[model samples]
Target: MGNKPLALTALSVALGLIAGCAANSSTTSKAAPADSGEKAAATAKISPNKPKNDYNITVNYELGMHCTGFDFTYCCVLPPYNSVQSQVIKTATGPKKYPELLEADEEDHSVVVDDDAGKRFKLSYGFVDNTYSEGSKLAYWNVPYDVDGDGKYEKNENVANAYWTHLYVYEGLKGANPKGTSKDSEKLFVGLQIPVPLDNGPAGAAVPSPMKGGHLHYSGEKGTIVYTKSPVLDNVPIVLTNPGIWDALGLPLTPFDDSLVRTNPLTLTEDLVRPFQETFVSLVDADSGKPVIDSHSGKPITFVGTSPIDVPNCSRCHSNETANGKKYTLYKQERA
Candidate 1:
């Protein structure tokens, strides 16, 4: 069972190599017989399969917080977070897949593409169906708390607070921000903002629930830039008034304030039903500032990858089915 994944991966690579070889063979010129009609027919069949572009993109992502505790009162629970990295290669350039060749003096094998086209190219990621906002289980879980530090948990529209304490808090040990004075310290902080009220109990009576969408600002060498994720478009184009953030971050600054490189909506779920999130990445043409489309698919040259979220099933150990059968009331109350 442990080796199944490795075996499957090896099989996939082999299949991809076979498909690539077949495609290449069809596109290459072959010695034909004297019958010109036969040669023409063969060429026609292969032309449809030939790729229009020689560019390829690879995407990868990692979950910043794998598992988040649901009950913040009992333990420290973290918000959802993930980071994505990607690279692009123009295969027609040379035998090497990477854009730049390794320098003779360079000790490391890391290759960086410093060309103007590479610099202008921008990458953006977003979810196809964002399940973190309204009517979702995650939103229901983001309850209000006693922000004022009173003994009683805060209530919204007569609904007693179930989870969450502070609106926004620092991410480090004991929620301490060591570089709080520094301009770049915003990224180190994590908090939820409630822009809209949530339906807690009675009809027409709404309370200030956690809004899972907001502008995330982080400082760069030039200045601070804003990245927004809403219930509509999660992690799509970044919006920033300052062009310095774009130049400093190596992304193109267009009039629309968004990288034209669009991604198909990622539909992977991040709740108990799926517990995984997917993101797509595509490249932008340096000259046209448009998405590089795949010739075969006639769509954007996209690479999709998934990030795992460990949504703990606390009931497995905390329910009434435990060995001693002494039900933990705190855990039971959460489920209720």
Candidate 2:
């Protein structure tokens, strides 16, 4: 039995390597963004401009390839880029659509994409899908803008644009709040946003809760720029049981529940615990320090929070069967 287990573990590793290598071939062609311009200005403020139509800017998003692990747990795959994403920019003369160009390779873990405008700068988008939770995607986009127009996107640029964003769809929370019980529930999607700049901002900044409505403002000589997340007005009191908070909701169970008997009782406020349905994040144009918008849709370029409708069902390829005196069986795992 020990030998068999060892053999299986070796086989798992071998298979993982094979799959990862096969996927790697598809990843190397693309590139990640540079790092120079990632610093947030000492002074920036919150001011979002309306998206403009007929702005003539458009973004073309491309997804390269995927690599899988031996089990459902360790595979390195990225969620499909948002079904919708756009950005708008404001100039002294007028507002213009700053188109985005996204090229990502999940297998290689490399990404290169424009921040708020074309060729102004590119940001590296590093991401891995949250396998434990269905429809949950987490990634960080931060790097220097392409200031010299040389077509080389690197991080050494003086101005940096970087932040972390979390996106969650409604499917995973069905069991947590079935029937849309809460009056404040938007029944849409939710997200968490954090602005992490390399060489700017104060030390030890207070991180805001996604559930609680809050905005970040940085003021520079140019103007005030804002980063906003939707407010969670509808409160949901998630129960903390002795077994600990269940999955799906993934809420931080009250620390007071220190025993197996569930003796200590506590309820965390919705604002501090629950996430909002919709949130907004942006990389301001390095020049204007303002949020960019999509010219075609006239909205802040956004990404689709939902996963692609079509995902391969592993069970289809790994099924068990028994016929008369014969049995055909394969190991199985649940899909997110």
Candidate 3:
């Protein structure tokens, strides 16, 4: 949970491979500079099935949003979190009561105002640096959670989201190069969960007690993500988990995109893997590539979001392998 330091290491290696060289057999690419964010993203490996090639390979890192088909929930009960302590409020009658209130007042902590009822809310915050994987991309996500889900989510309180929005990019390369080997091995930045206010300021303060709130809260369309080129990026998977991942693409979120229920990012399902069939099948061979046919009938696979294949997934077969790996982690896709 306190793994933010590792992200720098991974980012260092990723950037090296990217700016240096592909995993060519003749000579290794020169390493990146001591201070560069791009150096952090260059650490990746060729898929096990990838075939070696000379010169740069033309592939598309189709940074799209897809579901993990795995969703679970846990409760974040309120804590006597001492961190949320804030400045005392001077009412017309007198100062406030309660040990918790006194603690907040003494600390001069800014109160979070509730969006629904416009009520004053107190909260607690804490920071945890997390590492996780997305496809082949090894990423570090700075996950700060409101340990005391007592409506306390902030950085000024020295706290962060229940998950992570800040992501560190890493690049991966192939072969046993220590720079590549160690970097790639240490590259994985795993699952990061971040929940937060609308902006730098707190949004949900002093929420109603005995209130009914969803366990995993996500403000739809609030998620966005950014992308860049990298060597560690070869077989990275595409998932839509970044807090701002969906919005950053500038993709349309109309009813037209999600009408099929299965195609809906809101209601993604594996049963509808058919929606990605053409793209998937195209990764097979031109001869092996089959049209999206119906499971019930032998007709072509037809549905929304269907289109011809292109780079990224398609170019890899001859160059590397199929783009079938874990999801890509968050890069800096949104502004602070």
- Give the C-alpha lDDT of model 3: 0.23
- Taking every candidate in turn, the Cα RMSD to the unseen true structure, in Å, is 16.7, 27.3, 28.1
Q: List the candidates' TM-scores in order.
A: 0.37, 0.19, 0.16
| Per-residue lDDT over 1-336 for candidate 1, one digit per residue giving the tens place of the 0 to 100 score | 000121244543443342352354345544667766555333432432222344444444433344546666687654333333344444323222222211111121112232423333444444334323322233332445543455654444111222322222233112234455323335321122322234221100111112122111112222322233346642222322231111111111111101222332233222223444554555554446577666566888656666454545634434544523554355455545
Ranking by TM-score: 1, 2, 3
Clashing residue pairs in all predictions, respectively, total: 2, 39, 61
In model 2, the worst 10-residue window by lDDT is 244-253
Q: Specify the poorest-scoring 10-residue window by lDDT in model 3.
A: 277-286
Which 10 consecutive positions of candidate 1 have the poorest summed lDDT? 248-257
Q: Which stretches of candidate 1 lie over 4 Å from their true place?
A: 1-53, 64-76, 95-119, 131-135, 140-272, 285-289, 295-298, 313-336
Estimate, for each residue in 1-336, the C-alpha lDDT of model 3 and write its tens digit. Answer: 000121244543433343232344332345577777555435454322111111111112143332233346653432111101111111111122101111111122223222222233322121111011111111111334444355764452223333222321233211112343333333322112222222211112211111111011111222212222256563233333332110111111111112234222444433322222111011111123334232334554222122211222322232222232334323224233
Evaluated against the true structure, the overall lDDT of model 1 is: 0.33
User: How do the candidates rank by lDDT, highest first?
Assistant: 1, 2, 3
Top candidate by TM-score: 1
